[model samples]
Target: MEEHEKDLEDVPDMNKKNSIIESGEAMDQLITIDGEERITSHNEFEPVPLTNNLNADELDPETTAKLRGDAIGDTLYSQSFVLKTLLKFADLNWNQQFEEDLCFLWDMTAEKSVCEYLWELSFPSVACGAVAKYTENRFIEIVIGTLANVLCVGCDKTMTKEEIGVIIQELDSDDHLVLIQVMRFISSVAFSSSETPFIDEEAMNRLCFVLNNSINTELLLKTLETTAKLTVDFKLDKNLVNSSLYNAVLTAYCTLLGSAYLELDTKDGILACRYMLENVTNICGYIDRFENATLKLDITENLDGFLQEAIKIIKYLSQEENLLPVTDDTIFFMSAFQYIFINLNVNYSPEIFIAISKILYIVSEIRNEVERLFESTLELECFLISRSTKQRIFKDLKLLSKHKRKTVLDVVLENGPKFHFAFDLKDLKDEVT
Candidate 1:
């Protein structure tokens, strides 16, 4: 036993540090566990320099072009691979690392040269798949931002018919995030590109679906903006009478107005309301032009029905229960009425004149609901109105004298403050006579 104890003590202590070697140098300068005098040179294990990685002189013209193309292609391919992998891994519980990875890949592919390929190769499928499969807001945002960037880069044919179909399909998603991203992408493409992207019938129906059903304020606003952009060039009098697109526009406007009435305090809700009101003014302007041309026998049948719809929407929105009495909120309503009143004239359709007259009377009579709109003044006057307002009213009234519509004259006299009219009843009579 004493001999064994002595042998254990005599054995070299393995834990003791060896002065011949240190950490980080063992592989570089080979050192055995057993003490040795010789050490292997680091140069023997060094990697060979890549002298032939790229040799421009050894390639033909086709090869050279192919290589240049491959550089972009390879980059897009790698990015798409990474994005797909990350998308597969992404879920509700995805962490910041995955987000960073996706953002990095998106940044790498956001360049114009790479963006088209990236969009064509994988983005559409990946985006739809992510929306359908994942509920991660961060992932959706990254996908949306990336797509917006691609659109900004000018994707002429980047989206195939199938891809557009997929986007339309995703619009039906119950997930608000998915719908938002899809609409945002569509809006970006529509506004950014010089050419209008082809939006099919089914897509239009789906947009109407979103408008009628979506409760998300932001989504509703985006839907309205997209629909307006799509139909800006529409010939309302000729091509859009009772058409699906027309009905869609009407439905979207009504739905948005209703929502705005309900949720006035929220920023998006107010914006949606204001946007629809502005659209109404624009449509009225269009109808006014149509009427002027029709008066010269250039066209027949004034679009009185369209004008009535505009006025109805305005009146619907003007209801006391639907409005917010705050100065900022009422400004849009005041602007709408002022715009309609200034545009009304003697030559305008009786329906239009009646519609404007009714709205004016409502504002004047429903003092309790819209009193705050007129600065809480009891008098229905524009005496304190700005010079521009006075000029516009005078111009519209001059035009009204030409048509001699009595209802318009009476409504103006009853509701309009006496001092606001630039010309009086006698002047209107003299002009008519």
Candidate 2:
């Protein structure tokens, strides 16, 4: 085979590198045990460099024009040889190493121009048990981090969104783990300190398509988590956060909540919601973190609007009527709302706090039985006292002793019995203001 074809093979082999190398220290410390597989160079395990062998001068003009095709073909051919060597030398007893190797191979395979490679070279189930054999949490994190870096580099900052879409669609499998890795790449790139790489818009636009097309809930859950994180990292700016991608993620989270509402595995739904909550907090915090006085004023001026939308989302989740037995989703909504409100209050955003108080007061009035309903939910009282504009909460809550309450706090807290009955504990704050 020509040298270019060999290069194509090496690209996809990166996946295997990711899987094996990422399995943590055990796999990291792996040394050839014996046999034909024994390492000849103990100190130098460099990737058999493919670039050095591919001489551009050797390619005819016609072939040189087809850089994409030639590059892919070469990568595939090179990886094929590596796969064989790895499979042969693999130790069945050290399954973790084996699995890591297989996953690494998959990562590499997916990087190739061969769209069909994923289906063709998927790691067999037999290898699964072996790969996870010696799993350690810390090792898993390191391996994942390493794999994320490889993907970021391999994606070649220049890939158009369209190209990325095509590649993702043609990926070997709609595998849950594979999607998780991809999502990890997206999150990392968004937050990476290096200048933001040029990502193919066409490729990113396809995120919703890929997500909607997928059947794996585990993948969906992880995707949701990653999306939530991105929303925070990107501050939910429309330009920074793709609307299609964002909506698709929110839709998925809502879907999970709906499907698992009554199921035993609702924890997945709860966890997904928690992720969303954190993002909201991060976004809100960003407004405060900015040092520019003018920028800060601008953010603060519109803080009420942002908080309102977030409250609406929380309100949806907290709606007891939406589910049976009022799930952890409900509790999570309360907790998240309580936490967010506390932040706004401590930061002394009276405008935003009063806005929230107004909304909760409206809810209290409309949902007559609702007040009695969540009376045992400790989060409600914590939020009220934390932002206590109410005199009682300020006077009673040890934490609120230094804070003062306006008349608005009094008006709201005066009807304390209606709200207090539902709390899980005494107010966490010293004062209502």
Candidate 3:
């Protein structure tokens, strides 16, 4: 019995000693793993085991789409189970290898899906830092080519704004072709009408950074197109929007447009002007918001310059001969000019208002402007009723309605003869009347 009691006493001591030794080994292991000898207050606790926190289920659909899109061009004939499995678990550690593989496959196949997927992942933004570590220039080129094609609307119309937004978010993070792609896409979709992309400050900053740095003319024009679209699509605080970026895009676009001298059978200036107006329709509201210093200091300073630059571009274009590309461009420009002039007038910049009014007179006479800018003249008249700039239109209308001004009357009379050269205008008019 005494021997048994002695053994029990010894057992506890032995167990305690073993525990101490094991604990010491664990501490040593932690120190070695962390590659630090000094234990600091912040480093006292060990991290949760990676395996313990991993989810075993499939990734969310949005996440899966992002992964799949990014994985394109990686496989020649077979899908990678291991890659898919890692993504399924949301294992960020594997993203580097995955992006590398996707870029590789993108080069090998020239497959649209791969490029499309990469666009969706917007690899460089969210994954760019990691991607730069593993990727080379050649691979990035493949992705950029794919993005350029997609930006021009090459695929089936299945692509939606959400998918495009995912790609754009990534593009906004860098100042490369990805950034150009964002500009082109927004310009094409948003500037065509009042439609807007999924853009915000975060996205704009990324795009603006790219615009500020880019030298490519085509890409710069596309960026301008995007800025114009952004201005029109949303009711925004104009000053609050990235003023430097906006001005850069507009200046670049205007410079390129003049350099190209791309002729339009339609009144392209009016369209441009219209797009500009659409972008800044509610300057009063934007200015009112600037009453607060945080907004005014941050947002207003930029606008003063941008608005002046925009006025200069319009003034320059207004003086030049008109060329109409698409019909919308003309009508859009006319409306845009009206908005600019009014904004200037309301803000009491009479010189600018007078200069724009002179351009309106020129636009009314120019053959191209008449053809391109007149199609929706009636609609523009109606649009004026709803706008704060309605007071400015009375100047143009009074000339039209009263003096029988050749510039205005000719526009009203010449409308259908040239427009219906390819169609039966008389029959259509009779049907409408």
* Per-model TM-score versus the true fold: 0.43, 0.36, 0.41
Clashes of 2: 62
lDDT top scorer: 1
Residue range 318-363, candidate 2, lDDT tens digits: 3334433544455455555665555454343333343344334334
In model 3, what is the error at residue 317, expressed in angstroms? 4.9
Q: How many residue pairs collide in each prediction? A: 2, 62, 20
Model 3 clash number: 20
Which structure among the candidates has the greatest TM-score?
Answer: 1
RMSD of each: 24.5, 18.3, 23.5
Q: What C-alpha lDDT values do all the predictions have? A: 0.46, 0.40, 0.39
Tens digits of lDDT, candidate 1, 1-433:
0000000001111122221111111111111123432221111211111122456677788877766654654332344455454555445456656666665555544334555566656666666666556655456656654655455453445666565555566665565544655665676555543445457655677777776655555566667666655544442232231234334455555555543334544555555556555544444455465554433221123334334544554455444454433345455555654554445421333333333333444455555566555432212223322122333444454544344334444534555564444446444544443
